[model samples]
Target: MSNAATLAGGFPDLSKLPVARQAHWMRWFTAAAIVAVLLAIGRAFANGQIEWSYVSRFLTAPVILQGIVNTMVMAVLAMALGIFLGIVVAIMRLSPNPVLKSVALGYTWLFRGTPLILQLLLWFNIALVFPTIGIPGLWSARAVDIMTPFLSALLGLGINQGAYTSEVMRAGMLSVDAGQYEAAKAIGMGRLRALRRIILPQAMRVVIPPLGNEFIGMVKATSLASVIQYPELLHSAENIYYANSRVIELLIVAGLWYLLVVSILTPLQMLLERRFARGFSQTAR
Candidate 1:
């Protein structure tokens, strides 16, 4: 019937009220599009070449487990080194001295300008340029002996992370109120003492969230180390598939392991955010 038709109560039908039918129809169309994508994914998974049985068989293989352990270790070490470098660079960035700021800026610009894969390759093959690396007049070690896959990967990933973490650290430090710094100085704190004892503790509230994300990202980014023959999770999966030719299945296993690792880190990240954010409740009397 026409929307203008009067009801028994002498009121036009409810459809007479203005409504956006196009958006309503679009919602259903969007749902249908989602269903189509899902169906496509299902079809791909159902392909005979996927080999679900092989995926299940190798999911927890010993070598794969070892790779996972290696991945975790690399992520932790890289993130720790990155955090240290970030703090140092951030302090330099904040310093009033022009020389310190320039040095920090140069380091940041050079590292960020280089692609990560190139950095990894460079570190792995650095022995070609520098036969030995050590403090001059103290001792020296062969570059080839020191720059193993693990060490090279750590240096590349960690140094790259430092460039990013430096910005995060500087932002967090800037977030703290200027009054807090003045107050620390008023209380007989030296500049370094004030930063260490008063400012950084409070800045942690701002810093911890993104720092947690950097850690989790480092975990995922560790996959890149596979190119260096670092034997991380993805590399281990490749070794298996290379022998058996079960490429997709082994890849699936590696993906599942990565998902599991990320899933664990996600909750831990949330917990740390919450912990650092204590005392921020607006309702506090």
Candidate 2:
């Protein structure tokens, strides 16, 4: 019995490790510092000279609600279009044909190199280039005069998003093992069929997490449409603040709404990532 007690006493207690104890204290100190800074900032904002009534009025406005709806609509539509285009561009980037590869590279380079805001402006003013979009012999008319700000914003956002998403998709696709492709071909699958059925499924499992982040980014990027009077969330907030002259208050309201939406989206994204991760583990087993 005394031998057992001696052995137990000989073991070093983890709490006696000075480095580990110091590390724990360091983490606690860092967290307290962060909390202190946030509290200070919040107190300053609350006690500032700005009137709380303006913030209250802006939050309760029906226009702000409508702006939220418009923001969701644009995000959904743009993401749908972007994902579709991303698939095509990814395929092109991986194609054996030199022309297709060149075209895909050029498209990605052009879009990614330019600022999204510039792309939005260019699309909004696209009529300057062609003036008329229809065939010269058939139905020529001024295209710029007809295109609305909303349509232009949608096109610009969707196309640019597609370019970036394509590179992301290509990276995912390349991550899949070459052995899988060979196995699909051995079973008499056509090239396109193998890619679609065998490769894409696995690639998507890799791509989903980043795709979720891209969707969130697209939601924020839609705010650029407000510059052209598309009345998205930021624009709606701006309209209210312009009338009430409560710049910071209205901004805080908009920031909170954006935070809420992103918070909701983040969980859904995690759920999808988990679902996709199951397949990988099962395959590994």
lDDT of each: 0.91, 0.88
- Find the candidate with the highest lDDT and give its number: 1
Best candidate according to TM-score: 1
lDDT value, residue 153 of candidate 1: 99
Q: List the residue pairs that clash in candidate 1.
A: none
**How many clashes in candidate 1?**
0
TM-score of candidate 2 against the unseen true structure: 0.86
Q: What value does the lDDT take at residue 157 in candidate 1?
A: 98
Tell me the tens digit of each residue's lDDT in model 2 across 20-61: 333487889999999999999999988987687777777758
Per-residue lDDT over 1-285 for candidate 1, one digit per residue giving the tens place of the 0 to 100 score = 745554566765676468755558788989999999999999988975677888888998999999999999999999999999999999999999999999999989999999988999999999999999999999999999999999999999999999999999999899999999889888899988888888788888889989998898899899999999999999999999899999989999999999999999999888787777888743321
Candidate 1 runs further than 4 Å off? 1-23, 282-285
**Each candidate: RMSD:** 5.4, 4.6
